[model samples]
Every structure is written in C-alpha cells, then in structure tokens.
Target chain A: MAARPADTPRGRVPRAEREQQMLDAAVLVFSRRGFHHANMDEIAELSGVSKPMVYAYLGTKEELFIACLRRESARLVAGLAAAADPTLPPDQQLWRGLKGFFEFVGAHRDGWSVLYRQARTQQPFSVEVAAMRESVVEVITDRLDAALRLEGRQVKPDDLTAMALTLVGASESLADWLADHPDEDPGRTATRLMNAVWLGADQLMRGVSWRPPA
Target chain B: MAARPADTPRGRVPRAEREQQMLDAAVLVFSRRGFHHANMDEIAELSGVSKPMVYAYLGTKEELFIACLRRESARLVAGLAAAADPTLPPDQQLWRGLKGFFEFVGAHRDGWSVLYRQARTQQPFSVEVAAMRESVVEVITDRLDAALRLEGRQVKPDDLTAMALTLVGASESLADWLADHPDEDPGRTATRLMNAVWLGADQLMRGVSWRPPA
Candidate 1:
C-alpha cells in the first residue's frame, strides 16, 4: 500500500510524508545491513514504494544516508538539549546529559547505530555526522567550563575540548556496553561516570594531586 | 618481493612471521578503509606482496581480519599484563595496567582502531572480537578483585566486572580523544585516570560518596 497518492505518481509524491517513510525504512535497512551492504532496492521495497519514488523523495543512496543521519542527530541533540537545566548545579546538568544519552540510545537502538556506526564509514556522511558530534562536545564543554570556573580552576580551551571528547567517547562506549547488559540502569551508568570525572576533577581543581605509590 | 621460497612456498614462510606481516598490513588498511570497503588488492599491495599471497598466508578476508584482531588483542593483553604487578597494591596495579593501555594505544593507533572500530561490526569478526573484548573486561575484574580483597571488601563478581568494563571503556574513549590532541601525555592521562577510577573507587570501597549539593 503506497502512502503516496497514485495520481501524483513517479517522483512527485508529497515531499514531507514521503521523506518520513523513506527515512523510517532507511533506518531499519541500514541498521540490519550497514551502509556498504545496504541497497536502495531493499529500502524502496521495505518502504512500500517503488524505486523511483524512493529516489525522488530521498535523492541518491548517499543523500538518503545523510537524511537518516540528520534526522537521528537532530533527535539525539534535541533530547540532550531538552534534558538540560541551567538552574541546576553543574554536576547535575552533566548527569542529566549523560543519562539522556544512555536512555536515548537504549530506546532508539537503530537510530544510534546509524549515527554511530553506519554514518561513520560513508564519506560525506562522516563529515556531516562529525559536525553534529562537535555540537554535542561543545555542549559538554560549556557545562565543564562552568563547573571548573566555579572552583576557580581554568583549563585551556583545548584541554577542555579534549576532556569533553573523552567524556563523549566514554559515554558512547559505555552506552554500547550497557546495551549488552540491559538490566543495568542509566542512573547507575551516569553515577559511575560522574564519580570518574566530576569527583576526580573536583579534587584536581582543589589542587589535590593523587601521588603514585613508592 | 615474495618472502616464501618456491619449493617450500606452499608452506614456506614461518607461520608466525608471515601471519604477523599480514596482520600488520591488515590493521593499517582496515583501520583506514573499514571492513567492507577494505580490499584484498590494497592489503596485498601495502604488504609488499600479491593478492594470492594474502589468501595463501591468511586465508579469506574474514580470516585475515580475525588474524589482525588476534594479533592486536594479544599485544594489548601482554602490554597491560606485563605492567600489572600482582605484588603491588591493587590500586597501584590498576594504575600500572591502565597506563600500559594508554601507552600501547599511543604507540599503535592503527592496531587500536582495528580492534575498537572494525572488529565490533558483525558476523565472523564480532564473535571473536566480542570474546577478545570480554577478556579485556576480565583483566579489569582481576585488578578490581585484588584491590577489593586488599581493602577487606567483598562485592558481587558481576558488579565488579561491569564497573571494570566501564573503566576500560572510559580509558578507550580517552585514548581516542588523546589521539587528536597529541600534547596530552600518557603519563598525564594515566594520572587523570588514576584520580578518576582509583580515587573514586577507593572512596566508594570505604562507602563514601559525594551527595547532591543542596
């Protein structure tokens, strides 16, 4: 059953609804087969539309991938942004952000895979996905900046950026780990991370150095 | 130039050496091109040999990937294992082992990428790579066990394993972050981690945790 009107045939389907259906199918197919192995034919078939209809709505396979990435990236970033509370303390803000990340990935497994694994391999998609990654990192850096400044400690912007990136990577790696062990709670994951980063960082900011054993 | 002699060429080159070379090339190429995109032709070219030579030396593409993964996995294990001294206190041993992990990745970026990025994809590779990943988690568990025992604390084995996995994932995430910012020394990285994991873990073992700032 074609979601688009039969009379408005070929490449002329309603731009909005057609795009949504195509992206839904793209997420499913790409997650199952990955980028290189996934074919346009399968996407069209799964979307309940003809090949040309799929192409018209989504452009080339590359464009279809970008669309999928853009949609998912927006969803994740929006979720993180929405979860933030500027009124809350820095650690609480960071914890909310990390919890949102894990919860989002758990609920949207296919979307996360497309963004993290599938989009990373394809050429143009990688650059586009990376920009979204930078946005997320910047969000974390801004929070870390406020946190460190409150303690009268200031790290170089570059170090802050690296720390943000490390936190993001760690969250991602842990999210995947949590995926495998589904019984674990996101709150616990976030707590573990805060202990690793914020607690240690507070001590460092206070000039408390952990010395190596002699 | 062909490494194997004609008469004994069929089985000529010592299995260990040839296998090492093949894996070396495979890690470099696969890390760059990823699994599905990496071609045997390119791997053969990079290895200073022929396509047939790769097949002869390392079996199919999947097999070569496994070989590369196995080689890198062994190096990571050995590096950390040698550095982790059971004779030392548990905290010191964990610090040493994590330091070894960061240093190993710093010296071998290609191997790290192959093991982290490429191996997690799917199929014949994932089955073994997942196992390799589990062993790494086990190494962390061993360190956790020693540390907890010394402190006269007892916890569920599975909980410790999960936390250990969290630490390893954090280290790995930090490694990838450090790769982009080369100025961050592994010693500094190790110290940061020691503060994060060892200090917080020490506090947790003593049943102390920072509460919400109200």
Candidate 2:
C-alpha cells in the first residue's frame, strides 16, 4: 500500500484530532494575543484550517472559548486533585497542592493564562468563566475543609470557602508575578506560598491575633 | 443673561468637566464590553456626544482606554497613598488601607472593574496596566516591610513583595466576588481581609504551625 500523503487529509482526520488541533491553536493564540484582541480569523489561520472548518468544529467564538476553558480548567484541577489528599496532614497536603499548582501553571503557562486571565475578563463569557472558577474553588475548599477538620477545627463552610478563595487568588496573582521574575526557584515559590497561607490558617485555627508592632 | 445650550461650544465648556464626562463613559463602556469589544460609537453615545467629539477629546480608542486607566488608577493609588503611612504600625496601616480600597471599589465599581479586570486581561494594555499594579504593590509592600521589620523578620524584598502581591490579588478577586454576592457587606469586608492576612503575618513572624489532628 502507498504511504498516506503528508499534506492531504488521511480520509478525513478523526474529530478528536481536529478538536485538539483547534484547542492547541486557541490556547497559543489566546495566550499571546488575549481573548478580546484574538479573532476567529487568526485562530483559524494559525490552525491551518479555513474559518468555516473552525466554526463547524468548534461552534462560535464563545463556544470555542468555553471549550478552551473546560479543557484547561479540567487539566489543572486534575493535577491539583492528585496532589491534595484529605487524609494527609494539613500542612503536607497544602504543600503538595501548592507544588502541584505551581508545577501545572509552570508547564501549562499558556493554557493557565487563557483560563485564569483571558477567559475571565470579557462579557457574554463571564458566567461560564465564573462557574469554572467556582468549581476550582470548590476543589480547594474541599481540601481546606478536610485540613481544618484534620486540625480539629470546625469553621463555617462559607467562611472557610471564602478564605480558600483568598488563598487561591493570591496564588494566581503570585503566578503572574512569578512569570515576570523567573529567576526565583519554583520549589521556593511553592514553599513561600504554603508558608504565607498555612501561617494564616494556623492563626485562624488557634484564634490568634496579629497585633501591630509597638 | 440667557442660559446656554447643554451642547455649548468646546470653548464654552471647561476642559476638566469635558474630560471627566468622557472618562466616566469610557470606564463604563470598557468595563461592560471590554477593550476591543468597546467601540468609539458607544462611548460617544453614552457620553452624549458625537463620534467626532470623542475622537477630538480623547484621540483614539487606544488612547481613550489608556486615559481611562490612568484616571482610575491614579484615583485608586491616591486613595491608598492617603491611607498608608510608613511610620504607623503595619496592622493599623493595613487596616486603614484596606478600608479605603473597599470604599473606593464600592463607590467606583465601574472604574475599578475596568482597571482590575479589563485592562489586565487584554494584551497591548498589560504594560500600562502592570505599571498601575506595580504602583499599588509599592503601597502594599511598604506596609508589609514595616510589619515584617517590626517583628525582626529578614525576608528578602522580592519575597515580601510577592506576599504583598498575593494579598492585593486576593483582595481584587474578592472584591469582584463580592460585587456579585450583594448580601455581603462592604464595610466589614476589609476587616475580614485584614483578619485573615494580618493574623497570618503574626503567625509567620512567630514560626507557628497548625498540625494535623490525632
């Protein structure tokens, strides 16, 4: 049998391969150009496909954005899920989870940027983006809840969730900040974050006050 | 004297008033529709002026977006600068600055959203936006440095700055979260943030840890 032509379609590639190509292109384009600045034309161009093919496969720009969000969010959440164990000690669990987060973000900086930064800011796309964020928060909150219980502390779920949001937001902001200054080691970055957060959690658990220096 | 028409000649209207009106409209449009999605037409409509009028006053879409960013960022920085004092204890200074931040966000939600959300997400704007963020971080780092110094801590400036960025980011994210969940009071939001952050700072100073439950 003759080898398949490299340039031509091999009896039409599978849907999965096409979708992955689109998503990979979308993540790269969205990260470099951002959501508002990136056009479907450009995305289609980068994917080496016609605009019609892109629309046929990915639906509208909004749907394409949602698909990107879902894929990236799922990846990061899965990575974090593997690292954070309810049964592990609170400190160790937090450390591992942070390391996982930093590692995921470091490896998939483009995907992370698209999900964390681009997808979040535009309108007509915020509800789904917000829902994705809520899902991530739920995961972090679950680990936090277990950690709190493991520490023999019983805080209100809402309050604990809110605090978890604060921690997660800080890490995200730090990730962006860390991107600019890559000289710092990743392990140290994770440890610093864990220290900043675990320090706060400990005080809250023990009912300690942070008084200003005299 | 006869009253003048509202659409008086450019010479008749003070430049300051006209600029302020233009900025107000720009903030609303940019925040609601995003940078690229927001067109000059809507800004002119919302400002009750013609498209030519907007162009004449603000130059171009890019310039107008930058102007809105500068105005809002200056207002926020000025508010925080007024609240932060290096001589004051870190806790007191942080408490005061956070109070100012929540108040500023509550009153100027549109402008705040434009700066914090819209500007940061879109590219070609990140440079200008990062400057604003850096200024805000400067204010935050000042207080963090003092707080750390008081407890005889010797963390590197970059590390402390990273911590401050994390806190600032958490507050920004929380502010957006609060905007949606209106039942949460703004007055107490700053205090809650302080409790979480400052309490953690205190614990870090003392090297305390929250261990797993037996």
lDDT of 1 by residue, B1-116 (tens): 65555445535566677667677788888888888899999998776677998998788998888888887888888888898888875556767787788887777766666556
Q: Candidate 1 regions off by >4 Å?
A: A1-18, A28-51, A113-115, A118-131, A200-214, B1-55, B60-62, B110-129, B199-214
Q: Report the lDDT of model 1 for residue A32.
A: 81
iRMS per model in Å:
6.3, 5.0
lDDT of 2 at B192: 62
What TM-score describes the B chain of model 1? 0.78
Q: What is candidate 2's lDDT per residue for A177-203, written digit by digit as tens?
A: 666555766566776666556566233
Clashes of each: 0, 0
Question: Distance (Å) between predicted and true CA of A163, model 2?
Answer: 0.6
Which residue runs of candidate 2 sit more than 4 Å off their true CA positions?
A1-68, A110-129, A150-152, A201-214, B1-13, B25-54, B123-127, B146-154, B201-214
**Candidate 2, pairs of clashing residues:** none
Give the alpha-carbon lDDT of every model: 0.70, 0.73
